[model samples]
Target: MFDSKHVRVFDEVVRTGSFAAAARNLGYTQPAISQQMKALERSVGSSLFVRVGRGLKLTDAGEVLARHAADILGAISTAQQQMTAIVRLKSGRIRIRAFPSASATLIPSAVASIKNQYPGIRIELSEGEPPDSVEALRRGDCDITLAFTYNTATEQPASDDVFAVPLLDDPLIVLLPVGHPLARRRSVELAQLAEEQWIAGCVRCRSHFVQACAAAGFDPDIGFTTDDNLAVQSLVAAGVGISVMPSMVQSFIRHPKVVSRLVAPAASRTVAAYTLAGNQNVPVTQLMLEALREAAEEMRRGA
Candidate 1:
């Protein structure tokens, strides 16, 4: 119940042996020091000092408090210093959850940049799909999430509890075997592949693909489903099935026998950094977001 300020004054009085001396040291009036001492005594419910002929003497309770004062003050001081370091970007930790493709592409560069710039920061990364990553963020298991949403009119907006930072748009690119009839074309239309077996990506992506195919007037015959970019490309290379994925994923993992072409009616996903509402402004979070934005910019330029 005792205030830290009052405890500080009490400790100073104990050290100096007089209210006037403690006040002089602390830059407070003697009466102010006396009032703080009285408040501290009331909080502890014990008499802390006794007058011993023009000098102050510590009572039993005062001795007990004095013994622990230095440790308490030292802990408070350490906490303050650590907080300052975090605010100044000198030291901190950021836990990030991102989807697989992004983890392989954007995350590596962004994390590396942040680590190189702020060596004292500790970054931990985990891979998950957008839904899982966002769940982890809301559960307070991660500081930031790298997620993507299919660019569609039906795509839901982020909830009120989350803040989304726009990174870059990753266009949906179709993957086909090198010798496939449409492989050499500048782009492929969804309707042209109505009879082709399909390899689907993640659940969200698969759903988007189906809807796009439906809009193009046919139901896709999906033969395999996997969230792995390398697996998707490998499947496409072997001519097992054609697939569509974010351009970022295609760029990160390319197969010699697989060719990518932009999809007609050009669908894409919006890649973003997601955080708890208001966490975007935190110094460490803000720094990581900036790194992500820069990485996205580089990818955009290269694309």
Candidate 2:
């Protein structure tokens, strides 16, 4: 195989038309240039140049190589430039998958911050809950995934190959109708709502709710199930049923008729950014993680 350095030297010699001139242009001695040409000729199994009086002349093979050398060098230079731009965060694309609640609250701010700071970096976002989003990360379909897990002892830890960067603790709050007696209370325990009809969220959220209710010693009377936060709030506002929601989601959108209270047992989910192990160091990915951290911190302070 022809070495890239030798090909570069050969291209320079063809451009300058002489070993001495090529050496001067490349900051190498004439002897070094001659040696590279000899090695390149050996690799290609052909003489690339011949003496025509005091100047160099291209053989038939030399002419063919010369014709392709400029294109090769140009392609190599372009590749180098693109890699440099990516490394410097001047240009790149990051694929991000976030859970719905995060997509509404944390992701918007984080995406905006990254866009403002590095306009050349393109971001593609899609909404997905954990396990699905985690699967996407493992499949290389996404570079980063914003996910959450309930901070319960029964919760399973992330897989060994996944890297989780803790962003914040998103507390679960009770959403009740304005006329509900507990609406006037500062906080409500899980057991207090056992008798009321309940509206559940996504499957994982629903599972967590059940677990929390079980911990409180009751099987909740779930009357409605939906993944839409707005729908959940709307049901509560209409006095159809009460629901529990992430404080982050409540902060982003609230129904005027629904009142939110902190949970007495203080249940929360650990929100984090997940990437395939070792991908957190990728330039664009790292920038996004940093933006998420900053956004999460701001939300924490606001809360």
Candidate 3:
């Protein structure tokens, strides 16, 4: 039988494609990693890796072992998580990753509710985009994620394993200066601002700008660009340019010099709270999901 420690070292080497990198990942010296790999090869009676020019490549035996190693390592991780949950009893940590807007608008109330009801349970939160957030969940780095997708072909979840609960529909709203002519209107038509100077924000927001403007039969004149929602509002309030921003960012708007109008022929992004489909349900994760849903409902009601 092969040792689990040796297998772990081998897996790391295969993943990194170099002994030196594997050593760094596994907290071992290059010589130590080399020794374990040799021992593993000796036990298996075959070479697992080959030097391919300047880099490393897995041999036929290595490929087979690598596939099995992933399964074994994943099983080990699941077992460890199970043991941790058992030892922690009903109180365990929930790790979450959310985009910036959701972190600002939705997560605060949800986190506060969880803290009030389950004070013993801990919450660890991180901010990341949709792809990175889902990747973190797959790597077992987080249990839940808040991600968004614009209603367009360019925006899609990278992984099929992402199971999401639709939180809210965040529509793009037009931000205009207080004295702008459109400020008097409750809703603005995209075509009405076809010639206006625009301050676009976020990659997806920019894409939406292009799509919405194109549908309105003209291209947008992007005069300024930023990824920050606050900066977008501030610039608009300064009478610099008009902007289209997500409704969630309304929570961050403190400037009284700007007016937000809902856009007709509405384009919107779907905000979803998600987790890996294979994620094990624990008490803490369940409670956190419930809290997020409750907070999202409150926000929807207020909107």
Candidate that scores best on TM-score: 2
The lDDT ranking, best first, is 2, 1, 3
Kindly report the root-mean-square deviation of model 2 from the true structure over all alpha carbons: 1.5
Q: What's model 3's lDDT at 229?
A: 76
Overall lDDT per candidate, in order of appearance: 0.89, 0.90, 0.84
- Residue-level lDDT of model 2, residues 70-96, one tens digit each, is 888899899999999999999999999
Compare the candidates by lDDT and give the number of the best one: 2
Q: In every candidate, how many clashes are there?
A: 0, 0, 0
lDDT tens digits by residue: candidate 1, 151-258: 655564488999999999889889899999998999999999999999997778888889899999999999999877788888888888999887888777679999
- Candidate 1: which pairs clash? none
| Model 2 worst lDDT window (10 residues) | 150-159
Comparison by TM-score, 1 against 3, better one: 1
What TM-score do all the candidates reach, one by one? 0.94, 0.95, 0.69
Model 1: lowest-lDDT 10 consecutive positions? 148-157
In the range 1-303, model 3's lDDT, one tens digit per residue, is 788788999988888889999999878999999999999999989999888897888899989999999888888888898777644544577889999989988899999987786676778989988767777878888899888888766666745786777888888799999999879998999999988999988775687679878988999999999888778888999998998888888765657898999998877889888887755365566677778889989998988
Error of 3 at 58 (Å): 50
C-alpha lDDT (0 to 100) for residue 276 of candidate 3:
75
- Model 2's alpha-carbon lDDT is 0.90
